[model samples]
Target: MKWPLSKKMETSLLACAIHKGEKLTNYCTDHNHLCCSKCVELNHRRCLQVTPLPLAATGKSTDFKNLSVSTENALSQLKYYETYQKDRMKSLKVSYKEHESLIVDGLRLEIMSFLLQCETSTVNRTHEHMQYTVIDMREKIKYLLADFEKSTIKEKKEELNLKQAPLKVVTNSCIRLHYELFHLHVAIPKVLDKPELSFIASTKCLENIQQSDIFIKENFSNKVFTVNGKSVHNVKMPSDSFTCDILAVCALPNGQVLVADRFNVKVKLLNQLYRVVSHLDVKQKQLGMCLITPSEVAVAGHDEVQFITVSHSQLAKGRKLKLQYRCCGIAHHQGDLYICSPTALYKFTLSGKLVCRLFEDTSADYTVWKCAVSPTGDRLYISSWYKHKLLTLARDGTLLATYTDPALLSPHGLHVTPAGQVLVCGWLSSTVLQVGWEGQSKLATLATMEDGVRWPRSVCYSSTTSSIIVGQWEDDTILVFRVE
Candidate 1:
């Protein structure tokens, strides 16, 4: 079926070089043909140099394909070599497919944000403690105003410091509880609110201690994300007024970045680049939001789909590759690309070809409005806006369980943290909820006011910085919350 260039073509050309009126040499480096020194000294010499060729008759030159085969085999082994390689990168998928439900990326950011808030809260508690110390000193003055004894008043400051440790321990206990709640968030019965009393009252200090309690009750609250001054920029709006999102971003080793701006519909190639780069109004309106993978760029819209290349002079003019649905979010797993939409999710082969619709759950009445896959890529958490509930789905699309709480009136957003914790936002309640897997425990409120919360339109987590950025529709302001 296959043949190498015949040795006759090679040898005949060599013999012609020698016999057809040319001198011979031991090597012909420049001409790449056998030639003599006489040929070099002649016009041929001034024209080219002579170099030696490998022994053709001895199968040296003939083994070129074998050499190529050897290199190909070496490369294949390299693909699996531990020191030389890692697991093949999957498609920059829109979904994780079966890997949808391990650890959630967004939730990890929240937990990290919560952790940061913890440190700030602790500092706030210490400040309150110092203020109380001053109050205690004043109380001793008031008590001795009538008794007027130096030794009696002197016991107050020493005793207050000695008693401070237990109060610190109680506050630490609540902090621990908060951390635990962030992990296992389910709406359980409220805790007893067994707040610790930092100051104790004896007959001598009764009135003063009561005042301390009143002061603490009035001022005690978690002090975190008390923003002094923060700013944000690089806001972009799509031509069709579609909501844009920063779907995915990765910083290169050189500090360059590739960002997938989904709604504005562009994969922006960037360096340390400008701080704010808005998307230009794309001219080719044939189909779909444009999303670029590391290798290929695909133009997609609500009703049309086409895969193309960036280097091509005109992507709209390039060969169009057809796809089944309007693609949305994409994710990368073990060498396959997964894409998601409001109604469905899909997997694709490496060749820009459709593999299959991996997740398609169209109930009789409602459709999935939003979904997020866990890190290990084994499960998916799907949310239905119409039904006001959530479903934990197996990789194969089986409904494993439904999660909801009476307190969850309007669940607008959902995320799973790396530690297997679920975070949800309630629009009507204006609160963020951390719920447990089995729906038995919960942090009834996170970062919401006692009166009520305004509807939070969208939320994202910055894992590198460990912060949660939420967009509040009603407040017309963005809130950055840190995790403890």
Candidate 2:
């Protein structure tokens, strides 16, 4: 029995096998043209062998099952390829969208840095358009794959009646073939390499901020601290063989003071008028110090604390306290000294008795340095130098909250104001930031390098004189800011 090629099949195969609305009826074996009569007359005029279509078809019966199986197998491979390409396209869409989200999030940080410096604009039109283009292509691919389900691949399956009792069937084979031949070779790279987004802000707003004093004050959140150049009190250390790098300072009730000259390993006593009275040399380099009592203070070195007292208008050394680990910062609260090492915080008595190792950070990158307790002694704040975080802990050293800000860079000194505000010295940024107890908000900046403060390593509030004293890293000058 012979099944003649239908008009639809002629239209489908016309581009390569049929001519002028005529179905291919004969196999011109000599010319290899399965052609209509017109094609035989025009191209195969000298052919020696010509077979009727049904006779040629009959000869191919033994291989019909093999031909159908091979075609189905090839289409099956195409189906798998098509599905993979479609999934990859969807993945690319999802991936690019995630990338766009991340890029915008990072841009938000950049925008925060530019807040006081410039004027910002809305999202870029070109960036949004490019993102939409990718989305549109993904939708188009989805619809195209769906439309392909009705094409020759599926139609051939039904025409051969192999859909139910499948002889190795393949699905969406045409869509797969189209993806490999066209989309993979042409579309993917362009979509992947499309320009993302770049945020641009104008700097003209800075001048407007300068001119409007009220706006400037309001923009910085009402607590704007300008440099009191005149109120800057300095105690010039004598030019001696020792490097007089003032790193820490504390004020006493009787108008006297203590200064930690770190490189020189000496703690200098200052008189009521910020004049140097006497210097007590220590065995190790003095880093952080706090007032333990009205007449005495405790200073921290690598692994020891030297208790010094102000007596007879001179600096006198008292009992030395040794610890198992190294000490970096010290804070005094309720007669107990809270000390910080590079990795842990410890509480010890005045007579060098260890209370407890309060907290140890073994989870992540720990760079715990300077620490301070709130006025109420309810919260302990620690500055992590490398992590760029200010950690607020409970009195017993339980972790409470972690604070981070773009303005906070290399935070070193930790000082909690009498009002429970945490003042931090951003060493690299050269700005002193006063934050809240919860580390949730920034209150104000007490001083910056514009106030002649250079590399401030330690900061302490003096309730006696109502002033905040700032000490530097390798410089001699100590800045005293009158906190209004």
Candidate 3:
């Protein structure tokens, strides 16, 4: 049935058959088509849920503002990958030139005269391969530029203003671009696949070239981390294991977890299955623990930092460095140790040399508790247990930003994922807050006490299993959650 045409319909151009001269007024849900009164009578007579076009537009479709923000964020990440690949290409070019020089230097005068033809052929092949890789990288850069252009300011503005914007189409296009960008990030490094170069006077040389393994793992959670089931996977330290407060937790690449018991002066290592594999006794009480290497760890507490080596689930004390003040929480990034005390942050070399006092917040309620460094080693995230806030700092210790929210109460432990998402344990709130790398946005409540996270004091993330481990202060139990 046709009603009086609305002002908009009257002013808009006709979108249906000329013979009927009818305006499209209804949307047929079953047939998925827009229809005029005559078309509906002829073709959609039996269709169910034939809704008026204006009524169909009443409900919200997609969040244009959030979409624009997400698109811009993805673009920024792509730009980071592009810059990284370009740096790799530069290094590859330098190495290629070095190898070429080595070949020329190694060729003797008489041997060069006899093997000139073979040398020229080998050099030409090597040079051609390098040039090919360079060209491939350039093409990848162009592709990323094109993808970024789609999310430009003008395009975003136009999309936001559209009355019937194709959100599904735009979303699908973005998903496809995200997949391609992730794979490109993995493949760009291998374009200049490392090739062994050697020079032989009489015989031909065989150079083995192997592409590095590529792993494309993308976290689309937007930091909305959560516990999957009614119960969190938790393991408690046995009575015989140790009687102490669990102050710090660190997850190793091999799926083992290292926990520092502050009162008992012990460090315990848990296997992949959350089983206690071994424990090490330290002379000083331990408050913080961090993995220095796959086989080594740095333990800090009571005004001293100790390095311990691990092998076959066994721990052996190696080196000890004395600090002027007590150490509470620790993190290692690029051969440097970041230690957080009650009032100050310190940076030190792995060899025990003091680097500099990064910063000190002497405010009565703003005690810095734990620290974590982003994978890029650019931003440092610290939890303020007393102040109930999270602080983001640059590598130079300059305060970048501070994050405080009602959900974030007495923040304790801090961990930054390789993806650059920041995770903070809210001790008083009994919840974990998943934050953005910039400390400007709170993504989600990663977990809560109801989910078996009780007074979580320490937190760590494992890339190997995509799991997060939480160590509680009062409780002896440790909780683990698998994240996507």
CA RMSD per model (angstroms): 31.1, 32.0, 23.3
lDDT against the true structure, per candidate, is: 0.42, 0.64, 0.66
Tens digit of per-residue lDDT, candidate 1, span 366-443: 345445554334456655555667667765666777776666655555654432345566556566666544333464
TM-score order, best first, reads 3, 2, 1
Worst 10 residues of 3 by lDDT: 201-210
Off by over 4 Å in 3: 1-223, 230-244
Off by over 4 Å in 1: 1-275, 278-322, 328-332, 350-352, 358-360, 364-366, 406-421, 426-431, 437-457, 471-478
Scored by lDDT, model 3 comes in at: 0.66
Per residue, candidate 3 scores C-alpha lDDT tens digits across 1-484 of 1243344432232345323567667767786555678888888889888987667545424343443343344444434444433443344445445544454444434344534554455546788775666556556655754554444434544544352233234344444455543433332223222211001100010000001101111232244566564324334555444444677888876678788776566788888787777888788877778888888889888799999888898878988998887888889888989989888889999887889999899985447788989765767888887888889999899999999998889988888765566888888888887887778888788788667877787888776656788888756667788875
Q: List the residue pairs that clash in candidate 3.
A: none
Each candidate structure's TM-score, on Cα atoms with residue i matched to residue i, is 0.38, 0.52, 0.55
Best by lDDT: 3
lDDT of 1: 0.42
